[model samples]
Target: MPYEPLPDLATLSLAEIAALNDARKLPPVAQWNPQTSGDSLMTIRADGRWFHDGGEIRRPAMIRAFAGLLRREGDGRYWLVTPVEKQSIKVEDAAFIATDVAAQDGALAFKLNTDEIIVAGPDHPLVARGTAELPAIYLAVRNGCEARINRSTWLQLVELADADLTAASQGVRFALVPA
Candidate 1:
């Protein structure tokens, strides 16, 4: 007997994919798969600034609009997809950076450069990648992308971190959700 594997992606129709991208409230970026037109000369800086054709995109609304369409593929690539086209975009390290952060009730909340607020607590955990002495903080962002914690926010988190963290098992742990 021969064994066959199930196909991925549920085989969504083209029109359905388009409709999904059109609807508001975080379009199904993880689902749609239109043909790749080509790469756009856009690069999202590590500081959460979006640039195109070597010019900084200062319009907050435009950046926010594009940020909504950002997606990460299984092959470790980033793309900005629409109903009809999927354009590749360069990400310096991670897509967005945490511009602001606040703590309340023993949990941390972060505001990303895209103006998306993420409460880093139980549902969306904050994963630390380095020593507590020099930690690289990251918050789970949309579709498997992580937003790096900025310097100021990192400082604040470090100051507020629990003192009982073991040396071997470093990194902040909490959960929040949106992405």
Candidate 2:
């Protein structure tokens, strides 16, 4: 798919943001139930770099294609699934990084490193981990995958938060601080 610039979230309503998010058509990895399983020899590093067999995958298109097929099982293992095979891939941290964020009309819109946009709401909730002083906030992406809200983006959320350190979006409020 060709790259398109993201619209200004600040100028868009929640409904518009949701439309922009669902515009992209992803693969049906969730519905694929392959009987073959093995290691993919791929790793997503903590800093969001993807490596395959000791070599870095420098192509953005390849990364995006692979990310579309990523799925996380109930056992906490990451896999790249296809119709014929499902291969486990190691993830050092979250599968993707929340690179940018914007507060839309009563919504929190996030931009992932893979150029995917998602709105934080009931279906895609924000989860806080670690400690209050050093929190790790994550946003649910898709198919049980999540994007770790990077430091700068997390700080943006902090600035948007109320006195209680809670950010509200789509009638759901999330605590910025770990509890």
Best candidate according to lDDT: 2
TM per candidate: 0.74, 0.94
Candidate number achieving the greatest TM-score relative to the actual structure: 2
> Tens digits of per-residue lDDT for model 1 on 70-142?
9887888999988788999999988889876655444455667776666664455677676645667787777
Backbone clashes in each candidate structure, one number apiece?
7, 0
| Model 1 regions lying over 4 Å from their true place | 1-24, 130-133, 165-179
The 10 consecutive residues of candidate 1 with the worst lDDT sum are 1-10
Runs of candidate 2 exceeding 4 Å displacement: 7-13
What is candidate 1's CA lDDT for residue 171? 36
- CA displacement after TM-score superposition, residue 3 of candidate 1 (Å): 54
How far does residue 15 in candidate 2 sit from its true spot (Å)?
A: 3.7
lDDT of 2 by residue, 1-179 (tens): 47776766566777777687677789999999999999999999989999999999999889998999999999999999999999999999999999888887788999888978888989989999999889999999999999999999999888999999999878999988888
